[model samples]
Each structure stands twice: as C-alpha cells, then as structure tokens.
Target chain A: MSVLVYTENWNGKFKKLSFELASYASRLAEMLNMDPIAVSIGQVDRDELEKLAGYGIKKMIAIENDALKQFDTQTYTKVIADIASRESAKLLVLANNNAGKSLAPRLSVRLKAAVASGVGQLPEKLSPFVIKKRVFSGNALAGLELRTETKIITLAQNSFDLIEKPADMVIEKAEADLAGIAPKTSIKDVQIQTGKLLLSDAEIVVSGGRGMKSPDNWGPIEELAGLLNGATACSRPVSDEGWRPHEEHTGQTGKIIAPNLYFAIGISGATQHLAGISASKYIVAINNDKDAPIFEAAQYGIVGDATKVLPKLVEALRKAKSA
Target chain B: MNILVCISQVPDTTTKVKFTDNNTRLDTTGIQWVINPWDELSLTRALELKDDASSGVAKVSVALVGPVSTEPTIRKALAIGADDAYRVDTEALDAYQVAAQLAEVVKAGSFDIILCGIESSDYNGSNVGGMLAEFLNYPSVSGISNLDVKDGQVQVSREIDGGKEMIALPTPFVGIVQKGIAKEPRIAAMRGIMMARKKPIQIVESAPVEPLSQTLAFEPPQPRPACNFIDPDNPEQLITLLQNEAKVI
Candidate 1:
C-alpha cells in the first residue's frame, strides 16, 4: 500500500502547490512507512514533472489523454479513484485550492472515503486521523476526526513548508481506459490576467478598503504596489462596491494570502478580512483611527489618511532604492 | 425559467466565536445570525435576473440545509425578493449529506439553474455545490464571477489560478458564485419585509445519512501580539523599519 498525491498543474507547468503537496505527502509516507506516489493528468513536460523528485516522491505517474487537456471534476475524480483503488492507498492528499475544493467532496462520494478540506496543520493523531482546520471563518480552530478506511485531506494553501529531500525518482506512464468519459461542461473561451504579479507568488501585498472612498482613488494604491513590486488587493467591501476586481479581494470570503509583509491602507480590519490575512508574517496598517480593529492585529501602525501617507511612503521608498 | 439559490445562515462576521458542549458545538448564547455574505450576493443576482424582462427568469427560490431555528433567516431571504424558500430540518450534517439533501430538493422542483456561495463562512468547506452537481448529474462551475444566459444556454466568466476563463453550458447547471456576480447585496425594504411575513417557508424532512467526518473539539485562535505605533511625519523611518526590522523589502 502507498500514499498517493494528486499533483495539480496548469499550462504545462506545475504550480507552487504541487511542490507543497509532494513535500507534505513525503512526510506522511514516512509516518506510515509506505512509498509515496505522485499522479498527474493531462500533458506536462516530463522534465518539469521530475522536479518532484527532490520532495521525496519515489514514483511519478503521468496519465496523458487528448480529452483531458482541460480539467473536469467528474473525469479527474473517476480517474483518481480508479488509481487509488488499484494502489490500495490508505491516505490521499491534495491542495485546498480552487481545483481541490471542487474535487475533494465528489471524490469522497465516489471512493467512500472521509474527506476534510482546508486542513491547516498536519494530522494530530494517526490512529484516529484527527486534523486541525480553521473554522468559524478563522475565528476558531476545529479538530476533526475521520473514521474511515481511506482518508482524504486537502491542505490549506500556504500552510506548509517545502523541504528538499532529494531522491532518484522513477517515472512511469500508464495507458488507462478513458472511454465513455463525457464531461457536462465545455469551455467557450479563456482570458488571462496579464502584466501583474500573481498574489500567491508575491512576498508583499498592498491592500486597500472602503476607506479609499471610491474607485477613482485607486491610483495611489496601484502606484504604491507598483513601487514595491507587490500584488494589489482589497477588502470585500471594495470588491463589492466595484472599486476593484474580484480577484484582488482578500478576506474570509475571498482569497487567502500568506505574504511575508502586508500593507493595509484605509482598512478597519474586520474579522472576515483578518481571517484571510492572519497568516501574513508582518502587517503594517495606515488608518486614521488608532482604535480601528486592524491596529490590534497589525505589528506596526501609522494613524494617518492613506491618501496623504501612501504618496509620501512611495516617495521615500523610491529615494531609498535610488540612493 | 426557475432559479434556485442555496443559502446558509452563519454567525455575523464580527461575532466573538465561542464553543460549548465539550467544544463540539457552537455557542449560541448571544450570537447573531445572518444570511452568509456570499449567498447574499447570489440572492441579489437571482433577484436581478428575475427583474430583467429579457432574462427569461420566471421565479426565484431559495434552499437552506438547516434546522427550524433558521426560519428567520429563510424569511429574510424571501424579503430580499426570493419568491419562496425551502428548509431541510437538520443540524450538523456533513458536506456530503448536505449536498444529498439539496439534491433531493432540486429533484423535487423544476429548476433551470442553481446558484450557491463559493463556500460557507463557518466551515469554509467549499464542497457542497460541486457535490450537489455530481449527485444531480449537472454541469458544475465553481468560482464564477459573471453569468449570462440566452436561448437556454449560459455563458460564464470564472476566476482561475492566475487568470480567468469563460465557459458555456446548457440549462440546469450549478454555479458557485463569488463577488463579481453582484455589485451589491439587496436590502429588505419595509414593503418587502411585510410581504415576506406572508410568504411561504416550506419545511421538509431530511433523509438521514451517515456523516463521513465529525468535529471532535475546538480551540480559539492565539491572541495577537501588541502593535507598535509610529508617527506619520517620519515616512523615512517607516522605510527603514521595513528594510531592517521586517526585512521584507
């Protein structure tokens, strides 16, 4: 028996989450004293798949099919369940990302395995298989127990570290019977966001809230982020008000980010907004109200209007860089 | 065209979360409940579609997987312009069971489209919509920001890893909606509130199923560290602190 990890890739390249899954699965395999196997779908460069070798993956299984170019939840779930059954995997791991969140529950239903999503930490106990996850929108943590023969866990995004434990990996290609696989959905077109740093890759993030007043006031915020080479984000209200794009929203109901440094301008730090950003290593807030809830969570606070403060801060950073 | 929006009641975002019953149950001593913000957006969009003369939407209904204690929440959804509401009387059902129950409701009704929040505020599982789609054998699209329907086909814009994708599906599909689906959540005016009191909230018995996962215990988050205030006049000092102390720049 082996532990299987479903490595997710996009555009013929593996995402950061693939390494994290491989790293965490390797650790889980060591605990269970079994070989860790990585399985992927669609077409990706074999050389790119080899990168998982450093994360303790002993075998990489690639199942390529022309029909599998795009991600289909039903097709992927059926294929994964078939492979897991064949290998007799006791534990399955995935990243709690957009794809994982949509696939895990359906996989559980098909495989009859107990599934847990948004798991924030390693399993607390092996025998009972208890995992800790954020609940109540990050206001509290819940310890969950899954009593099943096979357990599926989706790791929260940016929760674990990727350590290099190099291994000589063996790559295998399996020819599977993918007949009669009809997906209900079809892609009509795709438009990619261009010329901006992805939020997941940025070390620093510059964010604003409704305190910015209107969409017209976003010039300084964007300029500040441009100077720092950081991604731009906003609170839920800002997105709801149409002041910014929805993808830039970071909060409990939005994207969860774990940047090393986060700059909050004109934000009050509501519990929902704080839930998405609590993972940031350090937070700096620029709000006029000293008693704003953001100050309680921020490491550094500047009680001033962002309209006046952001321009000066940008200027200072520019001068520092040039000097 | 019949539209059904799945909504859940959650503790207000500002509530001080607490647990009781050996940390297995949420404390409800003084907690205030509201329609989950994500679902509020979905409901608003549903109402907008119903109001559009050319959208072909005939009625808007809401579904909830909760006990009778959530009737007030259902009434609030009706006040926000949903024509009817259905509640499955149950508590603490897992994601799988919740989806199954919702699938049963969908099967009982003639719905052309289904919508739900990307995930709930409490559990944040982000599973029910897709799972429901699987059970009903309907196409499911999660993280959809915009949706347009014409001639029994829907064209949607979905947020992906680093970009966006547009997909088209036939009628009777499930959409997990996010912020871009609606600009603002509609508020219940006095007339709508009065009308909601007379609206029907149909209570249905839930079919029981074993939960695959169970909550064992709970723990509050660690207290945040103290903050250090800086004068706004010295912007240069802020840069120095970020470079030397934070080491992030």
Candidate 2:
C-alpha cells in the first residue's frame, strides 16, 4: 500500500545509494499519496535503522537475520519478494547496484509486478506506474508504464542526486519466516580492489587506445584519471593488442559506460568503440584524424596526436589543481 | 558437458531509434536488429569450449526467448557454431520474463552449464544471467572477461574495480561473458553457414511470467551540437580550446 526502498548498509553505516534511494522514493510516495518506508535487512540494530529517519523516510522496516550478513542473491530476493507482498507495497524502488540488480528482477516475477532497471526519473502524475529510463546505454530515454497491480524499479547510478535532508519516521523490526534458502554461493574471500578508480562507478573516465603505444606509457592516462577521481578505460584494439586488460575495453561488445565526462586518447573513433561511449554526457576526442567518426560524435574534437595533447592537458590540470 | 547459451536479438548499436505509434513498441523504421553483442561473445566462448573439450564434447545449444523474428539471429548463432538450437515463441522482451521461461526450458533440459552475454546492448540491464541462476539455485557469475570449463567445473575471470577476480563454480552454473573475451569473432564460413540450415531448432510456446516493468515510449538521446574542430598542428590553440570550451582540462 506504500512505496518501499531497500536500504543498503556497509560496515554499519548507510551506503550513499540508500540515502539516494530514500530521497528518490520520497518523491514517488508523494506522487502516490503514500509514505516511503525504508527497509534495512540483516543485523541492523533498531537505533541504526532509526538513524535513517534523517533521510526523509517516514517509516523503517528492519529485518534481523544473521544469514543476511553477506549477500546471497536467492535469500535476498526471497526476503524482498515476501516483504513487498506482505507490506502491500505498490511500488518497490532500488538502486541498480550489485545486490539490487540481482534481486529486483526475481522479486518482480514473484510479485507479478513490473520491474524497471537503470531508471532515471519518477513519472509525472500522468500515470502512477509509468517511469523513465535510459535505453541503449543512455543514447535514448524511454517512458515505460507498468500496467500491473504492483511495480518494481531500479535506479541507475549517479542519475538521481542524493538529498541532504532529515525526516521524522517510525522504525519497526519484523523477522519474517525465513525465505528457506541456504546460501549456496560463498565468498571464498572478499578482495577489495584498491588504489584505482572503478571503471563502472566512475563519473569521469579517461580512456586510451593503441595510440598510447604501450602499457608502459599509460602513466599519463592513469594520472589524469586519478586527478579527476575517475577511471581509466581503453578501446577494443588496445585490449586485443595486449596493451591493456580486456576488462578495460569499452565499446558495443565491451562494457558500455555513460559517465559524465569521457576523454578519448588516440582512439581512431571507430563506430564499434564509440558505441560504448556515445552515452557519455560530454565526449572529448583527441586524434590525428579529423575524419574519424568519433569526431562527429564528440562535443569537442582535437585533431592532434593524443600523446602530445594528453600530456599538455594533464599538465594544465595539475597546474590548475595546484593553483 | 551440456552447455546452454542464451542469445537475445537487439537493435544494432548506432541505430537511430525512436518510438512506434505507441511508445511501448520500438520503431524499426531504419533500425536493423542483430544478435545481442554480449551474447555473441557468449556464443563465441561456448563454441570454443565445445571445441576444446575431448570427452564431455561440450554439446552446445543456442536458445532464445522471443518471437519467430528472432530466429534469424538464432540461425546467425548457429552459423557462428552450435550443435542444436531452441527458441520459446514469445514476444516478451522483458529480461526477467525471459529468464523465467529460460529456467523452465533448462529445468527440462538439465544443462550443466549456461552461458549468456553479460548484458544486451539494447536494455543493458545485465541482470538476467544472475536472476536465471538464482532461480535454478545455481552459482552464477556476470561480466566475465574470460572463462574455461574443465574437470566438470567452470573457472571465470570477471573484471572488478581495479583488477580481476578468478572464481570457480561447479558444473551446474551460469557464466555471462563480456566483450574482449575474444578478438574479432570470425564470421561464419560457407560450410558453417550451409550446415546451420540443418540444425534442429525446436520452437516451444513460452509460459506466462509476470513482467516487472513496462515501456511507454522510446525517447531519442539529446543531440550533441556539431563538433568544434581544432587545428591539428597548433598545440597551444588546442590546449586553450580544451581549457576554455571543452572544459576537460
């Protein structure tokens, strides 16, 4: 009967996406004439869940289960599907994170509700079940309407800004009957990737191609990405040539990213590579070829050797930072 | 080893897409549909595993949960390399719905390994493989950059934040292949293309599954203004423009 947000916690503190989802669901609740309730799964004490009241959530549902300590897609999905149905939630909102992406689709099927992922904005009151999302890797926006009785939606990363606000809310702890799923997937070890920006999570990305010549010369790309607090990516040719890891390749066949700023270094601007990055908000291509297709897509094109242009750009940024 | 590779047809990348008369349907005016790119990678890897295995023989079968129009792509998958193929006749494009139907088929077939593209180029949801594995109570991994199957176990290397995590799962699992898993996939040869004609393709009616979301209309992305070209030889001018106009600097 209300809008519910599955809040996320890391090391006893709420993840940034949780506040973002609560802030987002608050707007949706206002549209549906219902309250937005924040649900915290696992061993979150009442005090910890209640502290989320500062994010404008009117109510909190805390489910305490030791099994929920680590994420098992099946157990999490079962709990969410049960809660959504039992809570009589009209709409379920989640951040399109590792957990949310894995859980939302299954919950949708179990609840017979429409599920939307990579959702951007809430629907205008025109229809309660309508939502807008980025399609074709942010190349287009689509308004999708779910005609079902219940709906589930996953918001894309960085699309909705987290609100800094406080709320007066109620906290309720309910340990529902176990979803009957013993975790089959075990984390042999949690290797936290450190010392670099995550390509998928980065807002600003600087990528190179064979134009960088070799991996040894990749210091500039890494340095620039570091300065911007971004990630370093590469084209398919670079990966195939063994200059960079295949995971760094981004294109139609590679990872499709839609960062706020995409800086291409030495890429020939082939359509295949551009397919992955066309979704970027602002694309700046540096290549010697003025006729490169990437230039056509670039908001601004620099027709120069990437090696030469890159250093100057990095130098300029370093000086700007110092100033 | 019985491997089931799921392929989905999606609009070709770079296709200028728009909404149909109603927004729910995609307008195919100038657009050409192709096998999902990630699925193509999955297909390529599946074909490789089939070739490498000596005893298990890696019986590779391609399956798609879509309408008859998707068969051309299924045939394309056959051309790439597959022993047999299956398609559940349905017009549903939702990934979760497709996953449910796939689970029903897999339950009947009892495939030892499942392969899918990490994500479709069109929807880019990247959740189907994980959802399907969860539905069947099987171990699943997504965004795998490289994979191999041996000793009735599967090893997957997927890209994480900085490096890669190499994990092992039992045979009854799903592996979603990402791009860069292989270099330029070889187009089907004439013999392969001719052989694809004979591969048995069983079309089963899709069972009903609840859809999680609906699409009202497709909105094209905001157009970028014409590119501002800088003189190639002039380094200072380019630097000035990048700092003042492009603002990346």
Q: Write down the C-alpha DockQ for each prediction.
A: 0.61, 0.47
Choose the strongest candidate by DockQ: 1
lDDT of 2 by residue, A149-256 (tens): 888778765567666568888888778566456766554433566766557656789999877878888989988888887899999888888888777888877877
- Candidate 1's C-alpha runs over 4 A off are A197-204, A210-217, A227-229, A240-242, A252-260, A300-304, A315-323, B228-249
Q: lDDT of each model, Cα atoms only? A: 0.84, 0.76
The digit string of per-residue lDDT tens for model 2 on B200-247 reads 999877888775555667777667789877655554565566567656
Question: How many clashes (backbone N, Cα, C below 3 Å) per candidate?
Answer: 0, 10
lDDT computed for candidate 1: 0.84
Model 1 chain A worst lDDT window (10 residues): A193-202
Residue pairs of candidate 2 with colliding backbone atoms: A1-A88, A114-B212, A114-B213, A115-B212, A115-B213, A143-B216, A144-B215, A144-B216, B23-B216, B23-B217
Query: Can you write out model 1's per-residue Cα lDDT over B1-249, one digit (the tens) per residue?
Result: 999999999898778888899988999999889998788888888898888877888899999999888999999999989999999889847888888899999999999999989888888788788788878877778778888866556788877645678887777988888666877689999999999999998887888777888889899977778998888988899889888997778
Best candidate (score: TM-score):
1
- By how many angstroms RMSD does model 2 differ from the true structure? 3.9
Residue pairs in candidate 1 whose N, alpha carbon or C atoms collide under 3 angstroms: none
